[model samples]
Target: MSSFSADTPHSSSVMGRIFIYGILLIVAGYFLLPLLVMVFTSVKSMEEIRTGSLISIPTSITFDAWSKAWSSACTGVECSGLSGYFWNSVWLVTPTVSISTFLGALNGYVLTKWNFKGADVFFSMLLIGCFIPFQVILLPMARTLGFLGLAGTTTGLIMVHIIYGLAFTTLFFRNFYVSIPNELVRAAQIDGAGFFMIFWKIMLPLSIPIIVVSVIWQFTQIWNDFLFGVVFSAGESQPITVALNNLVNTSTGVKEYNVDMAAAIIAALPTLFVYVVAGKYFVRGLTAGAVKG
Candidate 1:
């Protein structure tokens, strides 16, 4: 009976593991199915795409669709392709991510380490921005950008992303900073460290995890943003998302399904690459302060 009981528990454990792994694989396949279809379709010719099923592999693979999508695909009346718009996103994301992350780190350092009167009230107000809908700020932000002479420009889009993204970044850093022991700041002050000195020497050096989190968040938000790209920027200054929209909807003699799939993949590649590279760090940063703040 003892031997039988031992074998039964071992069998149960194996069954449990199998059940969990089965569920995980199913979920992964469900989410990845669309991406696989896109990749398969992007390499297939129009003839195969129309003749074969949506999930069918290409009988003959070719990169002509990718080539055209990158350089010659018509987006509205222009056929300049996504190369320019891609670079526009690169420029916009670079400055916006850098400036927002730094400002968030600075704000977080001040809010947590340098306690002052009305600081909690200020923080409470700042959190409100996180919940505000993008549509609510559209008209006001447009007016503000117009007054600043940045309307419908890449610089204008940069400004909008930085300002709007501040709340979340600051919130991330503040939570992280709060988890840090206050005694560290006090000890620095005892050694004659000033605000900027302590921040540069201590906070930033230890802020790697949260910094990764902030960068990924801001990068994804700014890169994938369509509404802001459409509404705030125009013409040559438009981002890749807007360009992709125009490419798909632009009336042509033949609907280039393969080219459309290729363009969509191109537009999504940056964010996907960022996540693949830094996703683990992102998870670590998010949990760095979970217990404390």
Candidate 2:
């Protein structure tokens, strides 16, 4: 009887471990299933894809779709697949991210360390702008851009992202700089450090985490931005989003689902890569800079 009692606890521990491991494996499989399917589908021949079950392994694997998506798939009379748009997106997003991040850091510093009359009012107005839906201002922005002769240019798209990005970036950095002690600023000031000096030299270095967060957020948002790209950019200036939409929506033919899916996946690759690479900093920055203090 005593021997049985000793064995009973050991049995329960083993059972508990088994249950936990089983649940974890099931959850892992559930998450991995869709990714597995996409990879399998990507390599499968079109005939196989059309005929086979989604779970079935590819009878023969090929990189035809990838090659087509990169260079040959047609959008209208244009045979250049997604290569041009890929470079276009890189051009637009780089400037937008850099300029917006710089301005946001500036706004954050001023709002946090250097309070003056009407600062609250100004901050409130900016915060209010954040909640305003993009759709609401679309017409006005379009007209305004058209009037400025800025419509249909990469510059226009960059400016638009900057405007929209400012609100969130400012909010991010302001809250972040707020958590930072003002004594640092005062110390810099006592040493004859002016606004730019303190901002450039002191606060900027410590704010790397917040900057990473801001960059990642703005990069993803601006990179994936379909509506703005569609509206603000036209002709060759249009980003990959526009090309992607064109690719997926041809007027006079049977929709190529395989090409469309492949294009979509290719378009998503850069943003996905950005997140995968910087995801740790994204989380760490937000947690440390925003919430910890």
Candidate 3:
């Protein structure tokens, strides 16, 4: 009877685990199916796409669509493809991410370690920036951009991204830093270390996981930003997202679904690659940030 009771609980646990796993697998499939279909469609010729179901695999895979999407597809009167816009994004994202992440780290360190009277109020004000809808600020921002003579320029776009991105990055780093022991900062101060010294030596080093998380988050956010890219930039300064939009919505030609899919995949690849490479770090940062506080 004792052995049978033990075996019954073991069987029940196994069944429970199997049930949970089955649900998770189903959810994963639901999300991944669209990506799979996009890839399948990207590699197929137009003739094959018309004949096959949307989700069906290509009869023969071809790179022609991808090649054209990257190098020869039309956007407006320009057929220069996604390359120019892609590089424009790269230029815009790199500086914006770096500046925002660094500023966020600095803001967080100051708020947490060097805090003074009214710091909470100030921080609260900063946090409000995160909740304010982008739409509410669009006209004001556009006016500001024009006033600064940055409208429709890459520099202007970078500035816009950095400003919006700062709130989230600061929130991330501040929350993460709040969970860190104050004693460490105090000890460093007692040891004759200055603000910059302590930050560079201790806080920054200990912040690797969060830094990775911040960078990846900022990178993805800035890279994939369509609304800001479109609104803040134009002509040669427009990013790939805007270019992809023009490619898809061009009124002058028969839409090439395959090329559109390929362009989307190309546009999506950088963010996806960043996440895949640093996914472990991203998970660890979230876990640490959650549990520490």
Candidate 4:
């Protein structure tokens, strides 16, 4: 048989694969259509947004809505805008992510290496806290904070986030450490390394992936949080998510749909940006550690 005869089937297979990819691309576009529409509308003038079909390209692109969303948009008497909430979210998310990730690492380390009589019970209780809805805890948490005189304060909100972020962060890191070889820890101990020393030097280095996972998860949760932020951090301390809600939820003379959409996009941008930057690390981290447990 000629070599050309064999090459013909190979060419056909390649063409079939290409056809499959083309179909998948079309399906992906279908799923992304709404997001595309939102982006287009966010940049369009209000008149263009009102007059044109949602999917149509704008005749005149304007940054007015974005500008309004950032700095001058009115939410009640406060027209200083979403930037205030943006900075507040940044402050909240940073400490929340750091503290939660650190505590999760500590929890995982303790769970994996140290066994006590009631360790399982303690861990179970913590895990149970995860299953309970935040709404259930919200009232009690509020009352407790108020009793402590931390209500409607930034510190109170941070404490609430650290509490909430604990469940998932601890779970993720514990599962990760479960996959790690016990022999490695024993070997480190034989070298006369203490618990904190071993964790800081040996285990923590290997835990970069899990830390990334915890940080990303906590960051998104805290940034997008509205209920906790609303209940705990009112006024100037409210996170961007709360501001976005107030912006879109108000009864102005006329509702600014374009501005609302723009504000929604703006409020989401930080978490979106974080994911875009660290998403690869998240996948890599989970895959590296998830199989061990």
Candidate 5:
């Protein structure tokens, strides 16, 4: 009876684990199935795509669609492909991410370590920026861009992203820094470290996880931004997302699903790569940042 009781609990635990794993597998498949179908479609020839099922494996795979999507696909008058817009996104995202992350870190350090008068009120006001609807600011932003002579320019797009992105980045860094021990900052101050000195020497190094989180968050948001890209940029300054839209919507020829899928895959690769590489730090940062000091 003792042995049976012990065996019964073990069996129940095993069954519970199996049930959880089964549910996880089902959820994973639900998300991955679309990706699998997209990959299959991207590799298949247009004829095969049209005749065969979306989930069907291609009898013969071709990379022509990928090549075309990267090098020769049309977007409006430009038939040279997404290469330019891809680079445009790179240009826009690189600076925006760097600036936003740095500012967020700085803001966080000040808000937490410095703790001047009305700091919470200031932080609260800044947090409000995050909740403001993008639509509400679009017209004002456009006019502001025009006033600043940055309308329809890459610079304009960069400014727009930076402005909107600051709130979230600031919030992230603030929350993360709040969890850090104040003793560290106090000790640094006692040792004669000024604001920038303490920040450069102490805070910045410890902020790696949150910085990674902030960078990935900002990069993903800025890279995937379509509304701002389409509205703020024009001509050669348009980002990849806008270009992809134009490529997909161009009415000159039969809709090429393969090319569209390839372009989408290409467009999506950078963010995916970033996440895959830094996802661990991202999750760790979230957990660590959630802790209150």
Candidate 6:
């Protein structure tokens, strides 16, 4: 095929392109305005903030808000800051994403490659799980957590997220795996590979794109979750989301808007970093998986 198709006309005139780009730029700026305001507010002193408009540029930049937000901001009477909660979320997200992705991969592999008497029914149940409202499960989940002695603990929170997120992870990988040809599995079996061996040597190696999708998806959900974090965990065990809430909404006589903004940005930094680095792959992976299933 020729690099340029002479028979095909260009989709739009140059002016049309300019109009499209102009609209896109306007929309982008509209969405990014909050972030710009946040950055400006976080850097400006309270005096400047009081005197200046919300969107005005700071004449003097200071990171004191960022420092205080990270370390000594008062959350009610306790002033431990979000640093501890940040690390708690890190530990929580790491294992949850890891375990959920692995198990979801296994579920996908089995449901797609190995036919069982009730596989369709089982997968449908999982699909149903994806649509179940988070609110509906709260009471039941809390009761279950209490029964298991994991209530008000980070470990309990991890289990809750993993269970809730499993359906999504499984659906992603299953859709992706259905696109993979079953012949690959048969050939490996013909070569005397066992189930675990086939999964380890073949399916796993082929699962990179879906794995990235699952990780990014699960990471964002678990890291940003406030309802679960607040409901299931206590003081030291709370995730950054819960702590950020405390920092922003406490009954301090003087509201530290700058500190609140910085704490918000800090809490958001990990998800932002993840999306910035791997975001392009996220959509590509979804499309790759969506091709067959």
**RMSD to true structure for each model, in Å:** 3.4, 4.8, 3.4, 4.2, 3.4, 3.0
**Best candidate, TM-score-wise?**
6
TM-score of each: 0.91, 0.86, 0.89, 0.87, 0.90, 0.92
The parts of candidate 5 lying over 4 Å away from their true place are 1-23, 283-293
Model 6, 88-169: lDDT tens per residue?
9999999999999999999999999997899989998988887767889898888998999999998999999898888888
Best by lDDT: 1
Question: Could you give me the TM-score of model 6 versus the true structure?
Answer: 0.92
Q: C-alpha displacement of 25 in model 3, angstroms?
A: 3.8
Poorest 10 consecutive residues by lDDT, candidate 2: 284-293
* Whole-model lDDT values for every prediction: 0.90, 0.83, 0.88, 0.82, 0.88, 0.89
lDDT of 2 at 81: 88
Off by over 4 Å in 3: 1-24, 283-293
Give residue 10's lDDT in candidate 4 (0 to 100). Answer: 49
Poorest lDDT segment (10 consecutive residues) of candidate 4: 284-293
Report the alpha-carbon TM-score of model 1 versus the true structure: 0.91
Cα deviation at 205, candidate 4, in Å, is 0.9
Position 190, candidate 3: lDDT: 94
Candidate 4, 234: how far from true, in Å?
1.3
What is candidate 5's lDDT per residue for 107-187, written digit by digit as tens? Answer: 999899888999998988987787677888899889999999999999999999998888778888888888899999999
**lDDT (tens digit, per residue) of candidate 3 on 1-293:** 23355734443466776998899999999999989988999999999988999998788999999999999999888998899999999999889989999999999999999999998998889878877879998999999999999999999898889998888778888987998999999999999999999999999998887888888878877888899988989888999999999999988777789999999999999988877888886666555433432
Clashes of each: 0, 0, 0, 0, 0, 0
RMSD of 4: 4.2
Superposition TM-score, candidate 4 onto the true structure: 0.87
Tens-place lDDT digits, model 1, residues 1-293:
23355734543466777998899999999999999999999999999998999998899999999999999999998898899999999999999999999999999999999989998988889888877789999999899989999999989999999999898788889988998999999999999999999999999999998898889888888899999999999899999999999999999769999999999999999988987898897565445423323
